[model samples]
Target: MHERIDEQITFRRLEVLLAFMEGGSLAKAAEMLDTSTVSVHRALHALEEGVRCKLFLHQGRQLIPTDAARTLAATAREVLSTLSSGIRTTREVAGYASSVLRLGSLYSLTLETVPAMIGELKAREMGLEVDLTLGSNTELLDRLSNGTLDAALLAVSELGAEFQTIELFEDEIFFAAPTGSKYAQHKTIDLQACSHEPFVSLHEGFATYHGFQRAFHLAGTTPTVAMTVGDVFSLTSLVSGGVGYTLLPGRIRGFLKDRVHFIPLDSRFQMKQQIGLTFLSIRERDPALLKLGVICRAMAKRFGIRT
Candidate 1:
């Protein structure tokens, strides 16, 4: 029985069972739980199998709970309530009730932006422990929406309506070429001039990929992309090795200075990637988030980024 419960029973299934008990019908339960009737029916069947009991009677179009079902429902309510209390207590004891801030950002920001932000945050909030996650723009946004991250630093254009964002800085996109390449001699180069050159780009989900697209679109031409890489570092490394040219933000130029030439695009083909801090609108009043927001704004100003 214990094995059966462990394999089949889940908190979501138990919640569904309780909702079914209260609503007395699959459709009603689905409506009350904001799920599909089929999902509620499936959960009920799974619950019955887990407990090895016939908890409901199928009477025409309605489901009537058996005595066993009512008893289990009562037990479930108590169990769920106690579990909730246990979780709350655990959080309090672990000092995570409010002092833990889970922050996420794009992989590109890890080198400088993230470290500086973490240092500033620690200086201001000595008791706060920050858990940082770095991923692609889409992955970070997904985590932010699902409550896995308290806030994220990402491209401002990628933020959705569900988030409230504070613009931190703008990174101008530049054409990166090998140091010895002919294009390296110019302060600014025309996009069309590089149209035939093999280009290395980040995959589709990256904000830099979008910037690359915009630059080419403005030039009214398409690039001959030879390869695609995951992160900015690798893409730049490829450019430095003379594999192919690529588009990247000006900030990375300092590190890749000797290896590659960072050339500004002609005015008509220039693009800027807007970076910002984003969090759920509902968490606007969270004290930790508020403090982080203040720190971000200050850092933006210090870096000469528009507030």
Candidate 2:
């Protein structure tokens, strides 16, 4: 039994074998690889010898590959493709020509904040591509910490010292109910008064979830949660459909204004969420991140969210 493969088998030999397999003739393979037919013959011969198998049938000038040769050629193609992907990923990790910005944010931001930021970024940088990832606040922060995301727009409360943040705006959590609901007439809501009312809430890890918990805690009442959804839009939809009510950030007021009633929470039950641009401290001076910071600040001012 062959315990070890021959050292003569190399990537160059595999490449030559694949080229020959595709071209179907020594002359054609040589032409495809920009080499001499004699060199191609030598490489194929060496490859067959190294593998200790009859890879081709030498019938006069026509050479026909065996099944084994075809299989090896297929495997070689996969190997090369995987290696190419690895090389590209290595370059990305090394920060080489990184024109693609991996930006993460909460699902709620896609309505306006993310779109505006991406549009502004494209205007400033030629040939720049933005990869937007939307998730919960905890998910975005985790991606940022692991280097999976170059930067993220999320609540800055849970950020670590290793990250540098630029606070964009401060948003207040408001009591949300369906339009024409009994609570619509109130200028502000007291969570205690609505303790018995059925409500839908965002799942934990979302920035609004913390606010939901905090407001209810401050109100000294635990709300009756009918359901917990993964995204803010779905939660808002449930509320709009009269399934329940929720506490959501004021930033999303415009998105559901027609369908839902947004009443500010009483002063004692108010929970403020500080939205910001967060990136690794080591990348604070990165040109793309710096430009993003500028865009976020301008967006805050334009939206009258500057704090």
Top candidate (TM-score): 1
The runs of at least 3 residues in candidate 2 whose Cα sits more than 4 Å from the true structure, single-residue gaps closed, are: 1-91, 94-97, 300-307
Provide the lDDT at 66 for model 2.
93
**Ten consecutive residues with minimal summed lDDT in candidate 2?**
90-99
Residue 283 in model 1: shift from native, Å? 1.4
In order of appearance, the predictions have TM-scores of 0.68, 0.67
- In model 2, what lDDT does residue 128 have? 60
Residue 66 accuracy (lDDT) in model 1 = 94
The whole-model lDDT of each prediction reads 0.85, 0.85
Candidate 2 local Cα displacement, residue 298, angstroms: 3.3
For model 1 the local lDDT of residue 299 reads 88
